[model samples]
Target chain A: MGFSISVEGGQGEATIKLVGELDAAAAPQFKEAIEKLAVDKPQRLILHMDQLEFMASAGLRVLIFARQKMGADVSLYVIGSRGPVLNTLKMSGFHHSVYLQDTYAPE
Target chain B: MDKLTLPAVLASLAELRRYAREAAAAAGIEEERSYQLQLAVDEIATNIISYGYKDAGPMAQIVIGGEITADVLIITLEDHAPAFDPRTRQMPDDDELSKPLEERTIGGLGIYLAMEGVDRFDYRREGERNLNIFEMRRRNG
Candidate 1:
């Protein structure tokens, strides 16, 4: 019903936690968060979408925007995306472009 | 058939999605297919509000309705916007989809996903209205 975004960045890694639905109305908020990350251009961008219930194309657009804005050198990871959110990404063929994981565990 | 009319604006999209979801449920659709139905409706509704009636304001409206057939569910979205059919949009082919993010353009992705998500999609112009029809076959357990 509602959307919220929280970001944390340090050590060349930035993590964003997304909750609720990511529809057209919430796309701007996600884009804004990505814009801020663009400034840092962190080596890794990990998106925590375990709590995300839905995602429309607008949300996918922002993900595309985030990848382009952050540059190709940055590794984008989508963590815990399931159900509709995962379906949207896969349907758009976006899942091929990102690292999808159930958890953000680095070895 | 059940229908809900909403102002053709971004804010009205949430309500329209809700209507689509409920209609899918009424037709005995499961969660995954229901979500696909919702996405299909949301994409075209967005195109209508964002492009069709760019400056039409609150006077412009979108009508969303659905009907349940014996083996299929049909959801329709009607708007008084331009005659542009979403089916005409250039969809991203496999080569384009396989390209890296930096090489890709965001245009037409929504339409591609919308059309792909539904079992059947049709566009029709009925006088002053543009109707987008989405159909999904009901699977029996």
Candidate 2:
């Protein structure tokens, strides 16, 4: 229904934990977070999505935006997405752009 | 189980979700099938609002309706916008989805997903309106 984002520092990476639904209304917030992260230019961007319940097409656009904003040199990790949320990412072909993991690991 | 209507836009996505759940349940679709139906409907309705009427100004109207008969779920979406047939759009190559952001073209991906998600797809241009009909059936039957 909504999204909450948190940024954490770990070794050489930045981990973002997202919870709740990511749709059109939530995309702006997600975009802002991505923009803020782009400034730091972390070597790795790990997204923890275990608590994220859903993702709309607009949400997918933000993921694509993050990929572009962060540049290819930065690794992107998506962790713990399940059910419809995971299927959506796969169907939209976003799974190919990032590393999908069952859990996040400290870098 | 019931019928509902709402404006056709991203904000109405929740309404579509509710309709999908009701229609799928009435059609005897299981959880997985219902989820697929929801995804397909979302793709189609989203396109009608975002692209079909993109330049038509703000007065454009879209109506979504659905009914379930036995094992089939039927959805009809009609919009008053420039004549456009979603079925005519070519499906984007899956290989192209990962292309660099600048090289990627906008649009068509949602239509592709909707087409693949449904068991049946049909489109008709009536007067100044576009009508899209979609049907979903359980994989086993």
Candidate 3:
């Protein structure tokens, strides 16, 4: 029903936790968070999407934006993406760019 | 079945999605299936609003109707904009998928997802009207 984003960062890695529906309305919030995180220059960026129920194309744009902003030096990981969310990523070809896992373990 | 009618524009997206959720549930789609139906509908509707209506100005009207049987859900969107068949648009091929970030082009990715989300997609023209039909198979309960 709503979208929420929380970012956790320490050492050389950063993880972003997303909860609720992510549509065009929430994409700006996502973009802001990623843009802010890009400045920190974390070597790894992980997105925890276990609690995310929905993701539209607008939200997908933010993921692409994050990849472009972070450059190749940053490895992006999406943890716990399934069902329609996973399908969207695969369809957009984003699955190839990031590591997708059923669970998140700090590496 | 239910119909949601509005002008084909970005502002109508929220309403479009809201109507889809209700329609999907009414059509007996389970939670997971409902989600894909909503996203699929939004993607196609967005296409109609963004590209289908490019020359129709801001007042182009889009009418979306839904019907569900015991086995499937059908969503049909009709607009007065220029006829466009998303099927003709090329999906991002494996070559593009393998490209580096800077070399990738995202031209039809959104529509590609829309097509992949649904079981069947069709586009046709009748006079000045363009019709896009989408179908989703419902899991046996």
DockQ of every candidate: 0.77, 0.44, 0.39
Tens-digit lDDT string for candidate 2 (A39-62): 888889888889987666777777
Q: lDDT per model, in order?
A: 0.87, 0.74, 0.79
User: Which residue pairs come into collision in candidate 1?
Assistant: none
Candidate 3: residue pairs that collide: none
* Fnat values, candidates in order: 0.74, 0.26, 0.34
Give RMSD to native, each candidate: 1.5, 2.8, 3.1
> What TM-score does candidate 1 reach?
0.95
Q: Considering lDDT, which of the candidate structures 1 and 2 is the better prediction for this target?
A: 1
Q: Please report how far candidate 2 places residue B111 from its true position, in Å.
A: 2.0
For model 2, the superposed segments whose C-alpha errors exceed 4 Å read: A2-11, B1-3, B56-59, B98-106
Q: How high is each candidate's TM-score?
A: 0.95, 0.85, 0.82
lDDT of 1 by residue, B26-120 (tens): 88889888888888888899899999999787799999988888999999999999798998899999888888877888899989989988899
**DockQ, model 1, C-alpha based:** 0.77
List residue ranges in candidate 3 displaced over 4 A: A7-11, B7-11, B54-60, B69-72, B98-102, B138-141
Quality class of the docking in candidate 3, CAPRI style: acceptable
Q: Chain B TM-score of all predictions, in order?
A: 0.96, 0.81, 0.90
Number of the top lDDT candidate: 1
